[model samples]
Target: MGQAGATFPQSLWDPSFLFLTSGTSEGGSREGLWGHVDQLNRTLAQHTEDIAHLRDDLLDCRAQLAEQLEKNLLFPQISTSLLSVALMYMEAQRKPDPEKAIAGGTGD
Candidate 1:
């Protein structure tokens, strides 16, 4: 029974062979459905491969960035050391008192 007490036919409720054949034919050849499925599978495989490659590339970039950061952090110390050596060389050229400069340089 449907809405408002309307009696529905028993055949409408039954699973008949005619209903199955008509439904399949209306959607065209089954081969087309199989082709679509194959295309979907190929696309999924390509995307999976792309994702794997991206993961590897991302990991490589992260390692390179870490190495770069380590080098960058060491740069300031290197620069300061170089500057100190240069200053010492300049002071030596000026013949400034070594003891005074080592302790505290005279205000000139």
Candidate 2:
């Protein structure tokens, strides 16, 4: 075929390129592949451990938030009950007892 019509130049098919395509390059050796695989395994193991720790931390945080939410929900009711009791006591004290007032006693 004419050079002008060739898809690629013949120089591009060098021996090093052939070796790489044939899985015979330095990085494609058995030992190199095994080393790469080992590194990948180590990284995956570390990531798994980190993910587990994060999951546990998330669970703890959710539980703490739930407890705080429960406490927050109860506080208003508790405060309202206490206020009602205080107001009732104050109302009772504000009105004088006629008998006690006539007996020269401070009725409030």
Number of the predicted model whose lDDT against the real structure is largest: 2
- Predicted structure 1: lDDT: 0.76
Model 1 C-alpha RMSD vs. true structure (Å) is 9.2
**Which pairs in model 2 have colliding backbones?**
none
lDDT of 2 by residue, 1-108 (tens): 476765432563766544544556552665665677699999999999999999999999999999999999999999999999999899886978899999998785
Against the true structure, what is each candidate's TM-score?
A: 0.51, 0.57
Which 10 consecutive residues of model 2 have the lowest summed lDDT? 18-27
TM-score of 2: 0.57
Q: How high is the CA lDDT of each candidate model?
A: 0.76, 0.80
The candidate scoring highest on TM-score is 2
Model 1 spans with C-alpha error above 4 angstroms: 1-23, 78-108
Q: Give residue 57's error in model 2 in angstroms.
A: 1.3
